[model samples]
Target: MFEAMIDPTAGPSATAAGPPRAGRPERLDGLVVGLVANPKKNAEPFLDAVGELLAAEHGTAGVVRTRKTSITDPIPPATLDELVRRCDVVLIGVGDCGSCSAAAVADGIAFEGAGVPAAVICTDAFRVSADAMARLQGSPGYAYVTTAHPLAPLDADAVRERARLALPELVELLTSAVPVAAR
Candidate 1:
């Protein structure tokens, strides 16, 4: 008897549909930075440190922060709308795990589609997941920042250090007209 085989590693059924990515600002100075934290361990402090760095080093006017209710889901439409309305540039992250990493990338793509430049932050361990998510969202080769892995166990100072390490790439994503694909 002969048997048929199936391939399970196919891509997503549909890619994301929307307008092109938003135009990046020339600089972060005087721009309102938005922070969207997923429901992951240590996400808030990580993003808070990033926000502080943006303010001190890049001269961002202020920051508006929010938390998503789920780690494996896209940002709620209302929250997305609010961020787009209020922020000039946004950072979404702390994607330390598989599901959260995908969701965070999706959120970043959504913001980009809505005319807001976005930088997504994730752990090094989840880069594959983040890349797959970006491709699925029709943003193949999209750029995002990654810090060292195992973010959940880090203390406040360590998390801040990770944020500090990721700041340059984050700044580049928000301020440059050219998109730097993730390596």
Candidate 2:
């Protein structure tokens, strides 16, 4: 497939290696959850579940969850800029689809360049083996979830409701999710 052909190239890494390394500012107090949902049947479910999961994982700091307008296209520049300005971390849903995965990676790069610290690009766990997922996770740069663990395996209504309830927690987790290695 074309995705297999396009080298991952470590799309986005955690902040930067080592101590604050000068230039970049320290992490932020509040974090905005950037949910890059691919336009797909399952995108809503995955994103909703992620919002809920993050909230449950963290707390209410800040959140800016959104979905891509199109599955084939990268996020709009304005949206990307706004996401960077408003969020410290981002999570892109791979939705068990290759095209969605690629779009997530692209969006991640844009967010990273905008100064977002960590970007979690979710991929299909079933499609890619656990070992491959681990390799992607261990890659020099970029934060990845290759396990194909969809945040929402259940119904969309349940996922969205759950996300709404956990929005606060998600915001908190995004701030705390800083890679310990970076610190």
Candidate 3:
């Protein structure tokens, strides 16, 4: 008998036609940012820290957010629409484990499909996994930022530290290479 193994964590994936990669918005100056909280325990706080950094350092205008009730569930269409409508760019948080990482990258692809610039956050250990997900989703070489691993197990201070360390890359991904016209 042969037993085949499958990645139990794989969820829905994205297709190549889903979205064309758009250039970044020209400036964070007065740009509204959408922060996606994937309902992982520490994701919200970590994302919040990143948002704060953006606000202080990049002069971002505002941040809107949505928290998924579960990591495995798809982000509601309404939530995606809201973020797309109100925000110039989006920052999705904490693609830590397998399924969550895949889901987060999928969400990033979805935003890209909507013509929004998005960056998914993954822990250092899962960076490879998240990139693989991006490739599988048809948005190979997709943008994402990496924080230290095991966010759920961290204290607030530790989480903040990781977020702080990740802030530069986060800004780099969000602001770099954006078309001036898109701003």
Candidate 4:
């Protein structure tokens, strides 16, 4: 007779996809924009570029901008609250701030608690190099994830052009789960 061995440590393997989510799908709408920047200087440039693209290409209704002063720090709760209150959708640019970008995903979750649609923007390198960055970072808290391929070394014009090309997809993805009128 043989008995199956039971390992106490045996369980489901940890995955990069992070957590499982289930809920009613939401729809996108034209409302307000929440622009977030990482601690890097280029973050602002990226945010500005996306904002312009969203406005010009997507016809975003309004705009709100916020940036984290330090990469190690979370976006301030007060600021997140303001963003939740002010905007229907938020576009958060992580730049090269990979870890900080992950944390920002958590911040987006916090904003979602207050009812705001949010997206975290990062260079494709980070997403492609570490596909788990968004997955492991994103929890049930955030609205969605938007990965953008930035021009190498953070070229402003290139980023702007890329934003123009990608903003529509980001807008559609971010707001896909949450309606503009809900907030």
Q: Highest TM-score among the candidates is held by which one?
A: 1
Of models 1 and 3, which has the larger TM-score? 1
Worst 10 residues of 1 by lDDT: 1-10
The 10 consecutive residues of candidate 3 with the worst lDDT sum are 1-10
Q: Judged by lDDT relative to the true structure, which candidate is superior, 1 or 3?
A: 1
Model 3, position 110, has a per-residue lDDT of 85
Tens digit per residue, CA lDDT, model 3, 94-117: 887876876787788888888888
Model 1 stretches with alpha carbons more than 4 Å out:
1-19
Which TM-score value belongs to model 3? 0.85
Cα error, residue 106 of model 1, in Å, equals: 0.6
The TM-score of predicted model 2 comes to: 0.57
lDDT of each: 0.86, 0.51, 0.77, 0.57
How do the candidates rank by lDDT, highest first? 1, 3, 4, 2
Measured against the true structure, the TM-scores of the candidates, in listed sequence, are: 0.90, 0.57, 0.85, 0.68
- Output the better candidate (1/4) by lDDT: 1
lDDT (tens digit, per residue) of candidate 1 on 1-183: 212211113454464453377898898999999999987889999999999998999899999999987787678889999999999999999899988888888888889989999999999999988888877666788889888889999999999998998999999888888887784
